[model samples]
Target: MDPLDSSISLGAASEAAAAKEDVESPDALLPWARFSAWLECVCVVTFDLELGQAIELVYPLDAKLTEKEKTSICYLAFPDSYSGCLGDTQFSFRLRHSVGRGNRGTWYEDGDLYNRDAPVPLQKEQSHLYGYVYFRQVKDGSVKRGYFQKSLVLVSRLPFPQLFRALLQVVAPEYFEKQEPCLEAVCNEIDQWPAPAPGQVLTLPVMGVVIQVRIPSSDDKPGDSPVTPSPKENLLPAPIILPSPHEQDLFQCFQSMLIHVQMLWELMLLGEPIVVMAPSPTMCSETVLALVSSISPLKYCCDFRPYFTIHDSEFKEYTTRTQAPPNVILGVTNPFFIKTFQFWPHIIRLGDVKMAGDLPKQVKVKKLAKLKSLDTKPGIYTAYKTFLHKDKMLIKRLLKGIQKKRPCEVQSALLRRHLLELTQSFIIPLERYLASLMPLQRSISPWKTPPQIRPFSQEEFISTLEHAGPQLTSVLKGDWLGLYRRFFRSHNFDGWYRLRLREMTHKVESLHLEVTCDADLLAWTIEKSEVEIVDLILKLREKLLRARKQQLGVGEQLLERLERSIHTVINSLPNDLQALLHRH
Candidate 1:
């Protein structure tokens, strides 16, 4: 045989042995024979600027079993960072039998797993003790892509007998959600060509671009929020979580942010003008990426900086390792490449701040000062009152974006007042607003709710319950119920319920301690008798009124009940409140 053919055969044999663990001898390990194939090795993960890149392992993260069990339950798995963008990626596994372990049989009509035009149908049967079994790779290693790495892990999975379920659940699907976009971006490119006619050669999809940022000097500050390495993060800055099944409301903030971005983008498209004020290195970049991605496939002039300018390329080489950032920034070499940034028709950089090209005029430049005039944007003030996220710094920065366009002074004031109220809501991190509020979220969001009314601000009370929001969540959670219960059993105040219950107490006390022998109770007996049946009935009416005051929240039904209680209490009183024996 030719030396090269001999070498190829020998190399193939050795590779197969390594896979089967043949060094131990199959005869010594009966009932199991292994086969090995290197197959093709393509990147399990890839990236594009439109979607980023990666390889994903969509496994049964909740599965759990012993290592030995896993061996019998066989499966095929790849390491990944998938967020499970592929909704239907799971496949079935089976055991095939043969007359002889070494026998190779015809496996498929089209051939093995390499059939690109057909589904990879699987076959396995009960042992006849005379055949060779072959396993096929149904789905090959895929080039996954996404904004984050978790997508690979989310969509891909380990083999059957799923023992890795628990491992998968340790993380969340959100960790790999973006993998769909990234993977799709890469996969679509592999089998796709740009739009074209029957004979005209089509253009290829644009390859991904890289972007790097240079903050110049953005060392961590003393008290800045640290970005955890995990792909998913809890909203609470302190790491506290709500009771099971409860999630803090983020609708207000997120919705508001989305609306603002949508409007800003639309305005820019309409040539309405833009205002760039203090652009944060962190927020500005994140905003740009998300904003661009959301409105993808749209043409725009993107002016991004070169690699060397974003960071000190020489310093990065010296360190050999640069810190990873929270905001996304893919790099080519010297500067980080903004993958999405490539979609823009042009890019404006700090380097161009002094340039004389038609760039500034060609691209709509809205200044930050102009946006502040939008004081009346209803959406702006709405979020200040409702957002439940603890990332106040992010909010403040985002708020700055639309502050330039706000209008409506009184409305804005009311909105701020409402914000103060919600900021101090019982469920939120009230600690931040403690100095700013009292028992009640005394103030409102600056642009919504009522203005801060001095004198009565601290005394913002609707009886013993809420006279505020329609939800009245605060009163339901506070001590109002307990206080109302205490009110039902008045200490010395004459009330109907108290007088009625007094009979029960008297009977019990009497039954336990004979009335004649209870000498100290003589004065109490005289006072209790003073209620008299008719007056006790009238006191009952007053007691009923106070009962209504408890456990009230901010609603029309509650308000009506409170009014009736006040009326009943006033009618029961023999004189004005001034004449009452329990007057404070």
Candidate 2:
């Protein structure tokens, strides 16, 4: 389109869409021709251009257009109805070919279009667009004589300027949705703005396309440059402001963003065909539409626009534009342009931009996240309580030791604490609470509520004869113990008094064995309890008594010593042995 084509300009919003002359391609279009065949399958079609959008084209078979006018008309690429628009939209279009309803075979009008499966003759309205061709006249050179208005009714729905952002989001999904975000905070000294330093370049990823940019050299250099001592060597290369991967892509994304904005600017009441000035060539109209269409703003209120563009010139030198101010972005002079177009495209190297490493003394920075954790059970946090006060010792002695010995101990990943109350396995506790709810006299404890776990009833508890949690588990295997404990918690304990008594006897026998020889050795070697002295003293007293009372006749003095010793032992306890024996 010419820079200022009146037709390309947007007409009054109230004015109806322009009537496009119906023209067909230049060629013999038989009833069963290729063009007609393609048309047969064209459920929808549209012509799009950067200039504007068009819809509802009425083509008359006899209608014709001049060559210049035909060439200027935008290309309608697809077919679809105009459901709606974002806001004030501009469209320049012409309908060239169309076929309406009312065909002879398998033809259904309006609601019945879905049932058509066979070819049929088309009605006048059904055959709205004429299948015609364009060719230069052999003699008169009259542009209008080439093809009559073909019976084609083409309708296109151009996006409203307001939807420009949405359109880009739809069309070029990768660029808009996936562009890298830019970096911030070069210094606390000044609000972040583009630095105008030489040799400053940063890598950027736009929609995945990567580029290195240099801050445009500032004829507007900052007042602050690193001070050199002793008139030292060369000034340090001016800091090149670089973008994180996200920032690079963000910059590229900004280009599309501009196009989107320009389109909306029109709808926003800044009516004008969006002009994108960059060193690169203009994009095809279809491409522009594609970029816009990728985003579906019809749903989300915010999205990307495809038609937006920033500066048209490649950053060949320090350029200034009110649209983009150095105060807004640190202009980096591109170095790749100096080498060749193919090698160093879209790259700028700034040498004087402020160094991000340099920080201001005034502002405070907060720490980011403390880091990672891995726990499968939601709320069961790792509880390793130690009496040790030193963290270093705890880590070295406990954590490291456990890791070394238990290679399969829940890997480092599975160690997180849940901040919320645990609902899981609470059933285990709940069942216990519910079973205890029975009336005081008739409370029956279930012994096997959970199949894998058994709760220990009073009977089972008596069998252990010690602590239910620790001692009972010692008698049974892990699985049986789990079942016993679960059942004991859930089932009612009734009609098992005799079994309970027997279990108690077994517990007593077990305790008897524990105390005999084993308890003494265990207490001496492990627990170091002094209870072993009681049995030792009893045996010594028996040996001394037998020796003193032999048939040879024991001495009275020795007998007295023996009796005194026995009295001493008996006096140690509240009850005397003589009284205990007498009571029995």
Candidate 3:
């Protein structure tokens, strides 16, 4: 059978199965519901000598974009070194935008209304749009610049670097050859993709290529399950591929700095401002992504610019020496940044990938002056001290594995698993402590408003470290209390705490409504005075009004039942009391 035909057949089968599932289960998300969920739009960015980077085209014509957004997309898509570059380059960057504006309607206006997991509108709305750009520079005598420079960009909310890269591999070449019509066909193919339902194995056919992947679930843990088939097992032509943090080779990028892995992890956790200096945009972006994702499952709350250049809007804001550098990680190829970001506390300089040999270069810590020197070595330059001690045994094991000629994949897996475990070990204690802080579900009263979550206290959390902490289960140990103390001052802790608190508050609110709906109103009112009964009725009415106003997913039947229950209690009261309540 022709490969394209096979892919088409597979897609049809999957769609039929999905439709059947939707019929059987009314809650199933519709196809293309999250089409914009992963990919929002495809943009073509070109570099003009006078205009710099300019937006050549944006697919789907109706993709709402602001002037500022277009400018950002242009610059990000075409890297700083585009003028001097000769070949192809691929990299990713995060584009910040106002949440409710710019391509948001593409997702929300569709069947996305049926998506229960849609993000709730935020008061101060800001969001990051990840851009995966494939840039190319080819010889062209027709143009005055002597070379043609343009970039094909994939704008998405998802951070699936590998998936997007694969997509670009198909879309970019054809689009460059056939232009806008090629993009139109690609978009049509993409429209056929199923909703990105987590934990399900999806065989997505994009541009005649059948790619299979298992979207990681919220509960998925690193090293807990095998995402790929084992070597001994038969490999399918379209095997289910596990998503990666980024498309870059993490092991290769960080091989030189293997010894400083723990310190780097600590710095990332604390949201310290660090700069990565590499030989190219590819290396810079890859290293930065790898560092940020070191603490897997714990989302890095701080901002990171994978390939930051002097032309970026925020360049001045970040480089202002009058104030301390903000908590962000920047990756750059130009050596000029070394002088500009000299005030930055931590900087990691990576060696040229081409010059790398079988043995990885040993990393060393250097002073500011040494870093500034033209002949300075590639290593970590930082004044930051880690609260936790290094895991000598783990490092020895990894080094031994490398010496024993282990596969690069195996070594990378071992490192990633270790980092994940380390992060989980640190987070588990906080999670347990936070769980204890929740007001007991039974304590939620129907007569009164839900209780607020207890404020997080650093001292209180620390006191429990003796009985319940990472030390209890973690193989790596040191001054955990001290680490937690410092962590309380970091942005990661603040972000994590706020998110957890909001979720808990929502949970409590949901529980309160359920209790109110199922409350034994008549029985409770039996011993209550007229004043008390009236107050309870008023509270219940307020809750109902609030639920409706907020669209809290409360069913009409549930609200009506509660209303009937309230009326029943009121009718049972004395005539004069009832009349008084009615008038009020």
Candidate 4:
């Protein structure tokens, strides 16, 4: 069992709450007896933006600057950033509380963990994660204005009494008995709140308002008085199988990133390797995993922990084998690996801040002077930083070509021909790419015998491409019922459901395109092909059509389920809320 399992377990609260309810209110049943009812109260919002937009949202600009300054600022500020932009604003926010520790467990002691010799790194501290968003005004320009915001603040670590009160406000059953009154009282009490001082005895009148409501006798039902259950209760919360709106948005963004990866992969086949740079390792891992998991058939296996493990021998010609998978490689920005694989194609540097052009270089002298004043070895680091800048420039050049407008005119026949050409040309060379990645040099070595690269022909490629349709179809035909059960069993939050649905959507769409195009391609190819090839294409086309229909049907069903779930939550709100809803 995982060590953090108890703390994070979805089952713990439900078990305790169920027991308490069985003893206290055996007759009353919640009108909507599901975990999602409670979860709907928590709001989650996310935004995505470009670097300039992010700077604009936070930075106080004197005037519109040249494009060069904007580029320089983006590169400078790229090192510490998160993935979300609200309009022209970039920010990350998450409200985390303890489920494992029962909403009051402090993960760390106040003073025990603090050290004078070595201060705790803010990133490592689970207690909080907050950062200021400010514009880089120019070289050596001081930040004109800045404000801090909390994104990953720990709520469970509040003082015990205050923590208990806050938890009761959200999770206590008694509080829900008179929700409108409680909400109004809470507002009035907050309005009258004074600034905290030493030995402050703050009290919330909302708690008193809730206490005034009569506790329903065992004879009453849930409708007479709405009782808020512990949010932790019930490992499986919602009856819905589809993702929430916010989750859907995030998933769509992820799919867009995957398409970029696919484009890069296609280009890599043409020997135009590119670099993908992100702000953090977590982002990098998430990107790779999301892409791989979307297509992987082994997604259902819970024990499977898929990750790329790059061996030292990957760069060494000391063996005639490869340890890692051929399709994808994960790389984090580190000195040793970066230097070794500097010449290797398709390098992805996570937490990479380097940018292309002389703008960054132009500011390097000013940067070096500051480092020197701070008693750092500026001379040693300058050359390394310059190399990074150059490498980033190479990446920038490659991406510029790829960002060009693609062929947008869509024709059923033309699209089919294009796919057929790709299968015939690109798929045929997949084996050579895999073979070249093996720990063997193309040139003969004097000391050791080099293993012969296995032969892979166009016949094999065509065969694989032909067989891939059915494999893809099978994968696309996902077990929605099984997924629903699995989701409930795992007790994961709504975010997990959102991501799963998003991936499912991506899988279905990719498969739909692949099969539809291939079927079309077969029609075009059959004119010049033999009877056997024509027969196979016809069979494959039928399978593809059926698969697409099934996927569409399932998608519709899932969407219906999601719509119903949202409506149920909205309808369950109190009379006052319903009036407010109508007013809005």
Please identify which of the two predictions, 2 or 3, would achieve the higher TM-score against the true structure. 3
lDDT of 2 at 490: 23
Summarize candidate 4's per-residue lDDT along 1-584 as a digit string, tens digits.
Answer: 64224322323444455456646864324311222111112111111233222232211112222343333222322222333322222221112222222211122332222111111111123332112111111122232223221111111111122122233433223322342333333322322323221222222222322211111122323123223222223323322111110111213213223213333323222222222334442344344433323221112112111111122212253112344223223423223333443343444433322334421111121222222222222111111111001223323433343344222221212222322343233222333333333333324332123334433343453344443422232222223223223323331213333434443444444334343332233234434434443343345444445444434333444334433433343354556754554464
Give the lDDT of residue 307 in candidate 4: 17
Regions more than 4 Å wrong, model 3: 1-34, 82-85, 98-100, 104-125, 221-223, 226-249, 354-357, 525-584
What are the TM-scores, per candidate, against the unseen true structure?
0.16, 0.15, 0.83, 0.23
1 or 4: which has the higher TM-score? 4
Pairwise TM-score winner, candidates 2 and 4: 4
lDDT of 2 by residue, 370-450 (tens): 111211111101112111122233223333434355332221111100000111121223334333422332122211111
Which residue pairs clash in candidate 3? none
Local error of candidate 3 at 375, Å?
Answer: 4.6
Superposed on all Cα atoms, the candidates' RMSDs to the truth, in angstroms, are 28.4, 38.2, 5.6, 26.0
Q: Give the TM-score of candidate 2.
A: 0.15
Question: Residue-wise lDDT of candidate 1 within 1-584, one digit each (tens)?
Answer: 75334434444454454446545755324211111110001113233447433232212222222332222122212111211222322211212222233322223322322121211111111221110011111233453322222212211111111211222222223224333333323332222222111112222221221111111112323122222222124322222111111011222212234323333333222221111111122222223323322211221222211111122222233223234211112211211222212222222221112212421111233322222231211111111111122334434443443344333332233333333343224212212222233223323221122232222222232232343322353322234333333322332112222332333333332222221122232232344443452343344334334333321112445434534543443445456541453342
TM-score of 3: 0.83
lDDT tens digits, residue span 56-160, model 3:
888767776777778788877776663345678888887677544745433432234323332221111236677888988899899899888889998876677
